[model samples]
Target: MTPLLDLPSNREEAWRWADLGGIAAAAALAPVAAPEAEFLDLPGAKLLFVDGVLDATRSDLGPVTLGAVDPGEHPLGRRASQGWTLRLATDAVAEPVQVVHVATGAENHLAAAIALADDAAAQVIETYVGAGWSNRLARITLGKAARLMRSVRLLQAAGFTSLREEATLGEGASLVTTVLGAGDAGTRIDGAICLAGEGGYAEFGGALLTRDAQRQECAVRVRHAAPNGQSHQLWRAVAADRSVASLAAAVEVARDAQKTDGEQSLRGLLLQRTATVNLKPELEIFADDVKCAHGATVGELDARALFYMQSRGIPKARAQALLTRAFVADAMERIGDETVRAAFVADADAWLERALQSPSRSREGLGEGSR
Candidate 1:
């Protein structure tokens, strides 16, 4: 029998590029003590899952289906994660769902899933708290004709590591996944995005900031299974001190999947000479009537821009933050929803300012950290 650790924890692919197993050990469960709830400031339906169990009392709700669940072993009685049988088929106008995965005190693996009704629309805010606890694995899914806009933010105290994120979108479905990472802890996130729909679209974006000996890694895959599907991915990282990071994005457009449009880019800014970053952009196309391209760039911050900002009344710290925000602002700005764009950009800008002031920035390297 295969050991549990080798069970495709769904995090291995991203880890393949970076050594994320920190010297610290992992806890078996998250704390049961009441944790201060940092309600996501956005307006939406919220759910709070402490550790691996749903905390009804702590949760902000929209009706509750209280029960125990396991991804490897489903409580609803499923042998494996698969099929349209698991998701809905009717079009749905989805309100945002904010999920707070908190490790109050104990530690355990956390897993969650979502099956959208066909033609449904949803926005999800996924956050992980790294406050002196061990937490691993958070998985989600979207059904046919469903639309999802998601963001995963990690703000843990130093010393955390290991994250497994998996998502699958069916026919005529669309998904946008974004991540913002920070802290002195060591952590890694593995992402898998599958496009099973024809004429569907998927956009994946993320940024990471690290300091000290902290380490973070991200691996993403977008597969075009049906004809005329579209996908684009952008990932960036900023490291300081003796920090290290790795990111790779793989896009596969299957044969017969005609007119597929895909593009991916990974770029970063190194703040210090000790920072280390690795970026790999890939495209696998078996279709003849498709357009696909990928590339990676690593370099230092623009000195001229920095100098220009300093020449003005702007302080160096704030100026650096502005540049960092500009690095990823275009991506966020392009989002069509005015409300979503405004709120998300505000949060992103705050993160960029924090990254610039962290003092762990690398002066020489490639990649910019996201706010």
Candidate 2:
């Protein structure tokens, strides 16, 4: 068993904004059996995991193999006793696959690996739910000219949930990822994208919503190791009722990575004075010929915009919801599948409605000076 001290803390630069105490508490508790809960109503082939172990009775794995794979060097990943491995045949095109993880134990760990052969293409959707401390690790490898699209949803966890994914792209490979986080717990997502081959491309879009003292954080690092590689990161976060949302994004360019194009945009919205949003964007470029840029902004809802909408006969709560929805649309648009995108957007909308309806002392001065 891993020691409690092995877990990351605020002293670490990468975990400076994380909930270390919550993580420690969850890790110290004893593991329990999976609880009873209804699975999400998602379409296509699916794999269900209960308490970090695959539940074959409730899963339809389709073509994805069920076995162990390499769990990287992460401290939590090393403790994973079970995992799944997925591989695509060369030049093959496959349908979408869904992977759902439910954590009801005091401590749960899972690992996953996805590899695409040359010229192969595929899409995957991952969902996380249930309570307790759930830690996950995933490693992805794309062969030459391979393409992969992935979407992740972190929803309705009542305890600490952490996920870390590392992806490496080969020559001419392409990867697109979209993430949505709206959990009622402390959630953390760490992503590392490495463009290891020339002409590789990677794009990431994420939307996060936190309310009622919940916390959500996403940290991503994109490394351009070869020439002509391009990567982009765009993220939006919304916090309400003393909740906190944060994003830490970084881009790195190797000395030999000429003509590398890297861009990052991080934006946050605070629904109340007590709510907090943190954004950090960093660029480390060793190549003088590369083009890398990053931007971050954190602010409250536009008072002028709300006043205008109110003057036009829209109620204050309704107007706020509409504005927040629009703010999250950019990240939703990154999803290529219309059906998946719509479902994620609907989840965000529902969360917003619930947050606005709940009475909270933090929202006391909502429109005080906004005449």
Q: Highest TM-score: give the candidate number.
A: 2
**Which stretches of model 1 miss by more than 4 angstroms?**
1-14, 23-35, 63-89, 132-141, 334-371
Residue-pair clashes per prediction, in order, are 31, 0
lDDT (CA) for every model shown? 0.64, 0.83
Show where candidate 2 strays beyond 4 Å: 1-5, 28-44, 361-363, 367-371
Query: Cα RMSD (Å) per model?
Result: 5.2, 2.5
- The TM-scores, one per candidate, come to 0.81, 0.93
Candidate 2 collision pairs = none
Give the local distance difference test score of model 1: 0.64
